[model samples]
Target chain A: MMSAKQADRLATAGLYAVAGVILALLAGLLGYVFVKGFPMLSWQFITSPPQIFKGGGGVGPQLFNSFYLLVLTLVFSLPVALGAGIYLAEYAKDNWLTRSIRISVEVLSSLPSIVVGLFGFLFFVIYMGWGFSIISGALALSVFNLPLLVRVVEQSIQSVPRTQREAGWALGFSKWETITNIVLPAALPGLITGIILAAGRVFGEAAALIYTAGMSTPALDFTDWNPLSPVSPLNPFRPAETMAVHIWKINGEGIMPDASAISDGAAALLILSILLFNLSARFVGRFVFKKMSAS
Target chain B: MQTVAVPSRVLSSQTHVTALTGPELTRPKLETDRLSVFYGDHQAVSDVCLTFKKNTVTALIGPSGCGKSTFLRALNRMNDSIEGCRMAGEIRYDGIELQSRQVNVLEVRKQIGMVFQRPVPFAKSIYKNVAYGPIRHGVKKKKELDRIVEDSLRKAALWDEVKDFLHQSALRLSGGQQQRLCIARALAMQPDVLLLDEPASALDPVSTAKIEELIGQLKKEITIIIVTHNMQQARRISDETAYFYMGRMVEHGPTEQIFSNPRSEQTRQYISGQIG
Candidate 1:
């Protein structure tokens, strides 16, 4: 019995309401977390080492570990992911072997982070005898990050216009040359975005690092820059716990008086770091795209 | 500079053949012998035998899906990149068998460059786009590259318009300028032949005229083979025109003869705007 115009208006209003509800839920959650956590943030709280039995501890080492692990994970995963992505997008034949490879990537990506953590613990920690070190943790996160990076790279390479490839061919460029000189440059923006997104995931990762990287940090000598030295912060063999793991640990074992406050501050910092990653991704992507695509 | 006997079809009275020894016969630049192209099971071009002379323009005119573009791509082995696309028969350039699998495709492409319908500029400066071919071929000196780029751009009739902005990204150019840049890119290789697949069909009238005029000047050096949808463009630019339909070349002769004389019913009807 409703007129067409009235029905259209009702549908539009319903859609808007649904969208608004989703937006409000996200905003409300972010607002609640920021209100509870922001007060604990300060230069002192961010720069000092944590205390085991007292209040007023900082997350300096854990924050450093988080970034170092993120960098190490990227170093381990990027080349292999880029190669696999290029093979899938540019050269892989539509056969059973390629199909199985693609399916494996999909299945690996969907595996639970906890499951990957357990696998890392069994293989890298016990079997490989890495002793729950930064290397082990980075290897675990690499496994977690590879599939997403591969998919991102593949989609980015495929999204470049076919005409560009044809132009390369017309100008006497071989397939590999064209891919390297033309396609890769054109796909740089998408590749950078994918890398940043993967970095964000790696930065916030907790479950995998807990089992593979261990839940404890050896005392790190900030001035000892030698990577071979056991106590050096740069040593990959030393046990290191990240900020996310720190937050989780503080929440579970509140031995310190300000454990809740430490957890609150760490959680806020983690979220803010992720927000920074996303913002930088957009900035870098746009800058590279403009530099490559226009004068 | 060597003469090959003309094909029987070219000698037949049905084509309104007036000159038995035309320039296409005495100074052939490229010749195809029973060339057929297939995309998987579907035949895109069938039994196409044609000859192009040095320093002249030959236009391939046909309706959409008539395989002119396919035929053009076959000359430089561009069809080799397309999945399931294959070809039969022989393509010869200067008495060398270009269609043989043993032939170096990169060298073939270097000697015979191609320009496509849509303007495709690389994600680089205008100067780099033109200079890329020479650089890849091992032209390392900066002075040599600058000279080559300038010469190629001037040859393509784009030098004056883009001289001051050589460092600008080629993608920033207008569509017509982009097409001209592609031409300059191909010219940088200094190829003996240039294959254009409707190079101006996407441009405005003024741009189209500019391209046509450029083509007229270019034919004096490189043998030019162009595929075009516009009848007027074919008539104006080409020395010889070949009409194709349903993947087959129907009629081919002097441009004026093919346009003015009644050789085949299909050619007449198509030219007169009856059937496309």
Candidate 2:
């Protein structure tokens, strides 16, 4: 039998080995993808629209669609999520009904994205007759994102110190004013962090958007600033395939000469954008934390 | 002017007895008629009848969980924010029933400001923290707000230290400074009555002394009600002190009487540190 010190040493060594393996696996995956994909990420490859069966085209429209869809989903989800969160954290009673609502949010959040996509396809696309448009996709994405945003907002609001609330009440602010001005500002770091993380997740979403936003990108004119035009990218009714869906589509069905190269470039761009999002989120969180606690 | 005629040496005689319990010319500024507070099934304060006179500081001193803080919160209806917390009995401010149906809680709170135990300055600039109350009440002009902020901070004894950094976030201040900033924020409302919930308990000796000094000076302007655990602080800063035991007011009179002359056995035991 080994001595106690030897056993402790063995345990520490084992832990380090496990950590090393996990780190190496993540680094290897990212390194492998970037090494293969970065070369194909050219200016020309990013600025022009995708070429069908031929060769070199860009991802401008799909990129725009991804950002637009992300913005639209956030616009719909943020308010509902924040309001529900505030109600849950600040106003909800400890009752059966409140518990049921909380449990439902948890259940909805844990549901598979594909399942939500199917529901969106059934309800919005077929029954609602939206017919695979940006709005349908945004609605499904919002549904997918609502539970997460609500949880974040609820936790953030809950984390604000009780003394702060009492101070506001003591200063004669109404309940709503206290919530909007004091509670919201104090919870800013967490709220902004949650929003950025959700944006990242929404940016990479494909399974749901493919069903609601459609896999085919319609013909578009970038200069058509009129929102009602069929070809305007801003039109919510138009089919808008995002970059993640574009990658999935190209990977599965492309027969072009440079299909592999296009996928490589798009994959690199996707990972790079996510990294940027995470970095910026960290920066904003730190900035807000400093502002709040510096005194 | 009525009180100034009495010599300090003669206050110990029978002349002071009626001065404390008798009818006053100003109706005691604020009065609580058999006020009681209950949290769910637990009764924290039971029938606490007391009066706070204008231009005088009264300290509520008791052991932990004796409902002193609860009693103070009741004066401004601060306990209303706590769910399942109920209060019975009338709280009158300037002859108007504060607990009445027609009374607006927000309006009552605006007139009666509070400073909490732990400092709770808003996570904003020093100027903003002090100016928030006045601005929210529709003092929109920048010049007016600047004046209020400076005047409030000056009253709290903080303007001299933070004069240059008025626009800086309040979070950067020291613990003592933050507490003073909270006092300044309350002062900006120009409240007629100020309630302090162990306002100096969280501070060091020096900061405590500074706050005690400010409180002494402030009693000349507004009716001040403070809750504190420190017996010495109670004696040093207030004109009258009420000793609470469990959920009841054990004894209340002039600070000198409560500290020196024993009325109730419980009050005597508590003052002597026999029972907490």
Candidate 3:
């Protein structure tokens, strides 16, 4: 029995309240990160490797390792994720087998990151005997990312109009060709967004990497650059320390004396990297989606 | 609605004669013999027999749910994509049984294309949209693709409007131009049969006229089967017309005969704007 004005006021109030809360939370987190860590963010702190029992610790090696791992994880996950998504969205009939796979993916998506870490530890670390390697950790992270990528990509593919598929077929294109030429390109934005989000999740991950990728920092060695060579510096099987692990190691074990400052610096750097990644992804997405919609 | 009963002797004898004659009538580009389609257990089209002569326009006219669209889709085996939908009897193209197990749906589609009620341009540049089919069938040379795109667009009569913006997205075109772009995309594949399921249904008057004109011109090059609710359109563009009622072919013959002197009372009522 509320009046029209009253109902409108109530709806407006509810929306404003929700927006306020979201804005407040984001502002609070950003403010805290900047305030606590800005003082310690020096050139040397950014460029130099962490030294044990020292006041000043930089994340130079950790930053490099994060990028390397991100690239490797994308390489492993992109093709498989996109391929599985295409099959599910375009080829797979809505039969019992497809239904089961969909259910399994839903289950995997909901499973906690820590559970994935535990599984990685059991399989990659203990069973496979790939003790504390970057490759192993990347593989584990790729598994974590796979289900997400598939769901996002499948949804994107589904969002593409059936008319487009019909148009392609009408043009005498095969199913595979139609998918590649018409459907995939149209769904590219959603696919890229999924990948970027997965990359962010992988970049920020600590618990899983701690188990699979070991906590030992490596010295820069240009000569041993082969990624697959067991003895090479780039070999993922070689123990590598990332930023998240560096922060955890510093704060928990007190390997670095001024743990508070170093942890804050690492946290700020992690936040910055994630923000940068997301911003770039958004920029690319805007361009691609605009072009797609225009076409 | 007036119901004139046809003697069973004529019906039975014609069916028997067609069955015995085999493929002697120099199989038209597309032919459907006693073709019926079912959705689950419910029949959508029943005992519909028709033939589309090569390089001629054949129109299927009916009220809503009479299965004209369903029959058009059956020609290209597009109905196979629908769940719980099945077809009975035979559809032959150039003396080959289309429903045979060995018939590749993809290859069949390559020869027989479709244009839907609404224009469905791919979310790609004008150039890419036309080039998509050609590229897929192993036309790798960019120059060749460019030539095909131009030729197809020209054939579709869209080249004059969109030639300068070939790189622009297809979606930016006006409705009529987009429909023409879709026609060009189909023409690029050089399909022998073009099935249009109310190609002008969603268009404005001008666009509809353009599409109707395109259909008239296209019939000279490829066999066309169109389903339309618009009687004027059927009369204007079709060489042959098949009128359907309650899933049955009421009458089918030369367009002039069906429109001017339909033997069936159902077709007469339908054309005179009485009972649907």
Candidate 4:
């Protein structure tokens, strides 16, 4: 019922208001993180192990542990996720079974991360009796990552043109051969992007690792590399501490004087790791996928 | 019209004057005994029986929704991929039943390749797109694959235009080039029967002429079946023509007869520009 000029003015003001709020929120978060955490970033704070009273305890061990978990989770989850995705997208017919499985996957992807952590704790820690070790943590992270990986890979494979599949078939190739040679290669870029994003999620996870990997730091033992041994050096059965868990523990106990410092260091490291993963994913897509498509 | 001097044998005939018939035809390389296609409850094609002679171009001409493309797709079992689409009756290629459940659809597709109405080149390099099938079927040697890629491109009449940029992405090509690349991809399998579903309907006039010329040359090496709505194209490129109306083949014979002396009233009206 307003005049045309008045209504137009109101609409423009509403659009600007929404944009302003979003920008303000983003800027505020970045400013707070930088101002609170930048002062604690130092060589000693990065390299030294944790101490009960010292303000600048190093995070070297925690950083190493995070890397270990990230690599192991990716190694275990990538193949299985890609395989399941290819099967669902390329081989499976659109029947009741496939439809149900697809719906289940969509549901799993949206479930809370904390819930996934709880399941990991039950299955890998208590049931398997692995205790607080890197193995248990990796298994937990793998479970959390599997559904996401599958969904991404499935979508990428499905995005490929039907004609490409038909072209392969016309060349006398079987379904398996066509998927392996044609479909998978074409979908690699999107698959890698999903893996990188999943890795970021795993690197930042803390709640799930709490019950599975524990907060206790172990002494370095290079000779205990035997994977079969229950107390092996690399075994997740031994208590392991990651950066996110360390931050949580230090902050909760209120014992460490530089709790803010530790949190800042952990947040920065997490951000850096995610950034690196995304950059590398982009690099791979640009060079490798481009070459593959043109080769 | 002026009547020429009749031969002595025709003059000696007592009963009536007989029109001259076309040349005798050979056995068909691919034949359908009684093909019927259904999409769930609705029937798409009904009791279509036809034969395609070896190394000859056959055209299935029809109006929209007349099931010409459906029949063409059935030749390669491409229709099998569609949900709720079912086919009854027998389609045989070289005396081998293509519709039997036991028969491998993959093998049938390999022997009888298909080109769709639209150009569909994979998002891969021109060379790789051409080499994709050869490699999957256990062609391990790189040198052999390279040779096959070149040969197929040459056969598709796209070799000279694409030879220098073999490593370029297939998507970077023009529409006409992309369609030709699709043809090359199909020919790489060395299929005996080539099924084209309005291959040139999506291209420009120049591109259409190029495809028509390619079809003429391909008949020397493979049996060709084309579905087209263009009657002039049917008369120009096809040796035999089948006019489909309302999911049924109203008339089928030599191209000259189907165009000039159709046997059925429906076909006569259709070809004379009186009805669809």
Candidate 2 residue spans exceeding 4 A from truth: A1-11, A281-295, B1-24
lDDT for each residue of candidate 3 in B21-85, tens digit (9 for 90 to 100): 23435547778899999999999999988888888899999899998888888888888877899
Query: Mind giving the per-residue lDDT tens digits that candidate 2 earns over B69-180?
Result: 9999999898888888999988866555677665678888888999999999888888888888898889999999999999999999999999998878898899999999
Each predicted model: what fraction of the native A–B Cα contacts (within 8 Å) does it retain?
0.62, 0.67, 0.54, 0.70
Error of 2 at A186 (Å): 0.4
Error of 4 at A38 (Å): 3.6
User: Which sections of candidate 1 miss by over 4 Å?
Assistant: A293-295, B1-27
Give the candidate order by descending TM-score. Answer: 1, 2, 3, 4
TM-score of chain A of each: 0.96, 0.93, 0.91, 0.87
| Model 4 lDDT tens row, B1-276 | 222232321122322322222223444678887799999998899999998889989999988899988888888888877779999887866555576545667777877888888898877899988887767657889899999999999998999999999998998998888999999988987788899989998999998998999999999999999999899999999999999988887788999988988889889888888877
The regions of model 4 sitting more than 4 angstroms off are A2-13, A42-47, A91-103, A221-236, B1-25, B272-276
lDDT of 3 at B223: 93
After superposition, candidate 3 runs with Cα above 4 Å error: A222-224, A228-233, A255-257, A285-295, B1-27
The TM-score leader among the candidates is 1
List the TM values for chain B, per candidate.
0.90, 0.91, 0.90, 0.89
Task: Give lDDT tens digits, candidate 3, residues A105-153.
Answer: 8898887877887888889888999887787888888888889988988
The digit string of per-residue lDDT tens for model 1 on B1-276 reads 434443321111222222323454474788888999999999999999898988989999988999999999999999999999989988877655676544568878888999999999998889989988999989999999999999999998999999998988898899999999999999999998999999998999999999999999999889999999999999999999999999999998999999999499999999999987
Please tell me the TM-score of chain A for candidate 3: 0.91
Q: Output the lDDT of residue A100, model 1.
A: 98
- What does each candidate score in C-alpha RMSD? 5.6, 6.3, 6.5, 9.0
